[model samples]
Target: MNPRNRNILIAAIVVIVVVVAGIIGVTSHKKSSANSKTVNIGIMTSTKQDDAIWKVVSKTAKDKYGITLKFTHFTDYTQPNKALQNGSIDLDAFQHYAFLNEWNQANKTDLVSIGDTMISPIHIYSSKYKDVKDIPDNATVAVPNDASNESRALYVLKSAGLIKLDVSGDALATPKDVTENPKHLVIKELDAAQTARALDSVAASVVNFNYATAAKLPENQSIYAEPINKDSAQWINLIAAKKSEKNNKIYKEVVKAYETAATKKAIKEQYPTGGELPAWGLKLK
Candidate 1:
């Protein structure tokens, strides 16, 4: 063979070998990646912006444990658990013990709490009155009409000296349950989601913290907010998974990633008042 022709043939062979080796390396990396686990979880936050913490949590979980996280966001409270139960997602990080307990009883599902999140308290806000005492005796106060928060709002009002309940310390008090109206106060019932926006129409309205964030109501404007530790364990929000997944290692890492200080700050920044008390360090008992 001619010397130049032989040299050209050798170069072609070397090129083919290099290309095949590169393809094998790429294929191996993809196979290794595909072998790792990815977790899909649902969260019902106030809005998409409030879903920011999942980004940080996802990054950390992926880096530390070769885990991939897919977050499904929900603005509605009733949807997360349904999505979880139907296998739309593997887990969810929404609702507290009381809400979950009620949901499980009503739906006959065995969902359970895996870990705690922060407690976002219910608050009463007044556009007209700064001090609860300064309000007119008969001033209309708005409360959430839903059974759960209506009771909570009444207790908040009772604690503020605004009204007296038939059961003074009842956690499930309703308007009819008000035994005494010293000021002849008319309790206006509105949808739970609307209570924050109804401030201009009523003397004051009790707002859920999530709805308060949605309405952009500053926490400073609150006439009263439920104290963090004062509230029962029923009020403590949590990360939930199927009772079947209680021992899931990946799901546990997802909770660990979310409970970090960085994720706590992320939760706080989503609200105007820097958010509620962190329940990360709290025990289940």
Candidate 2:
């Protein structure tokens, strides 16, 4: 063979080798990705209730995003964030922006919101009074004692025309912030879970929607509910991950799964009577 022909042959062999190598690399990448498809998420609610919404989300993630969602259930509000911080779970979806802020400030952790989920509105429920107007002076009104929730409950009271607050809408207001109580309302604070239970004893109690659902609080008993207005944006529920994973592609896909039409339908069905409103892309004004 001539030198020129020999050189051409070598060049052809090099081209075939590079093409074959590229195909193998692509196949290997797919396999590696498939192995990492399953992601574990932490939740602090009853699995039965969440399953209604997450069943749709999980199915969507699997079908459309090639991801599998597994849940790690915690019994209380405090555990999921701790679990996420410790790398025990890949994500958490049981908190609003205010609650997350409170937790992050207290724990000094850098968890950040990656997606909005829903607004679990807090309402003043009364077993005795037919309306907020009917509740007399010196009536005891129970509110959640937690920093964020206490502030939200006060805002709800202000909305009801039962009290006046001195703090800004976003401030973590307390009983001291109650600048005026025209009804001379007694602001009793209790655990968020116990607020619903307090309705029987107190004139009224500000109850988180989840606790109200768990307590089976009657719809008509809710005399006043906080508006889902611009100020309520901080109360919008969200999915949170570690700051390091805030921009993670798989995490973003999980958010996409939760924001689908099917998930919205499931949320409505699961939380009949508007206990939980889907908040993704909600234009609060």
Candidate 3:
């Protein structure tokens, strides 16, 4: 072959090699992007109640977002938050805002709320009396020992006129803030999970709805239950994730599943009479 012809053939081969390399690079990039989009969600427990809700989330994620959900359940509250902070999980949905805020503030972590979930109303259950006023003056009452829940128990007591708190507006009231006790009620603080059992010992006890339900306490039998339409800031449960995952597509899909009509139907069928009200937003009405 002539020298010019040989040089042209060499150049054509180089151009072909460059085109093949570009196609391979584009294909690799597409696969990498797709792999990075799968979402890993962490829940607190695999309890029967939670499993019911998660089924909806899982189905919605597969059908709507074309994303696979890797669901994990922590046995306790601490591990899920730690896992989320360390990037082990992308999102978590087993705690209320009060618990999340308390944990984040104490640990100095940057967990944020992406959306609200359901509100499990804490009820004041009485074994000895028919109503709040029926309890004798100076009788003992049981409340949760944790800071956030303790404050909520105190507020419930204040609402029932068993104690008076120096709270302005709708602020949370604490034991130290108790301004007056016309009944001089003896307050016995116990672990939140243990409060339901304290009913046999104390005049009455403030119990979180989950524990109450687990203990088989009938919802209609409670002496006092939080109103579903109160719009109280303290009532909203949240979907929490690291600040980095706030706008993630899979995280948004989980929130959407939580607020779907199917979720509302599940909640209503499971908790008729507003025992566990849907709280996806601030306005309950």
Candidate 4:
């Protein structure tokens, strides 16, 4: 109880208090850091079907992968790529190889595919006629205006025997490539997303799968549907990221999250009623 002993005891108590405070601060910081990291993904269209798939993927990412994945919805097929290029999103999942190649050439950006998603076949649907042969001569037909989709539309039309595309034209075929239009059909190029609406006005229109589903077209009942197979490799959909993030471990995991058999089931189930088919893409570990 003397003055020297009393001062020593007080100094010891102050040091203990400071040490305890430092420990608490460190523990709190660690907890905050462990919560997880956030990542944003860009997608073409937001639908209840996609929402279901996202719900499962988002929960799995947070619980098992320590990533908080958020999706930014876009109406235009062209928007997702631009968003990825400008760094507005961490990644995007709304394009195929042909479209990717065309965009890269057209825009001077270096986006690359991280993984594959699905192949939704493009088909020509006719609300006015029961068959392609029934289409009147000189009738107007609508096709997606985007270079990749336009070429696809042309292929479908050629397959119908209404026109003949020169062998050299192939996937790059344009309206001018038509060497013989037996029906003299008019090819009206419109935005890919608008082709379905154009069906009501044109004799027939080539519609992309997602847009067809969105427009509620009868794809299963369409007059002509593109066959799904290895031959359609160029139309296979993919998950894309900036060229710089191709090898990033975290982004790689995000890409793998969609490769699960369960995710594939969810994707296919989305179109149970019609308009789209799921292309379970490559499983890249």
For 1-285, candidate 4 gives per-residue lDDT tens digits of: 999999999999999999999999999999888665788999966778878887777777777788899889998877999999889999998888888988888899889998877777677789888888888999999999978888878877877778888747235668888899988788999988799988778888888877787788865438887765443767778889999989978788887777777777777788674344455544322
Put down candidate 1 lDDT per residue, 141-163, tens digits, no spaces.
88888676777788788878888
Which stretches in model 1 have alpha-carbon errors above 4 Å? Answer: 1-35, 45-49, 164-171, 176-181, 218-220, 268-272, 283-285
Model 2 bad stretches (over 4 Å): 1-30, 33-35, 168-170
Give the TM-score comparing model 1 with the true structure, all chains together: 0.77
**What is candidate 3's TM-score against the reference?**
0.85
Across 200-264, the per-residue lDDT of candidate 2 in tens digits comes to 78999999887888898889998988898876988998999999999999999999999988888
Cα lDDT of candidate 2 equals 0.89
Higher-ranked by TM-score: 2 or 4:
2
Candidate 3 has its poorest 10 consecutive residues by lDDT at: 226-235
Ranking by TM-score: 2, 3, 4, 1
- Local accuracy by lDDT, each model: 0.80, 0.89, 0.79, 0.80
Residue 222 displacement (Å), model 4: 1.7
Clashes of each: 0, 0, 0, 0
- Pairs with steric clashes in candidate 2: none
List, residue by residue over 13-93, the lDDT tens digit for candidate 3.
999999999999999999888765566777766557567766776787678777677887787767988988998888877
Residue 11 of model 2 has an lDDT of 100
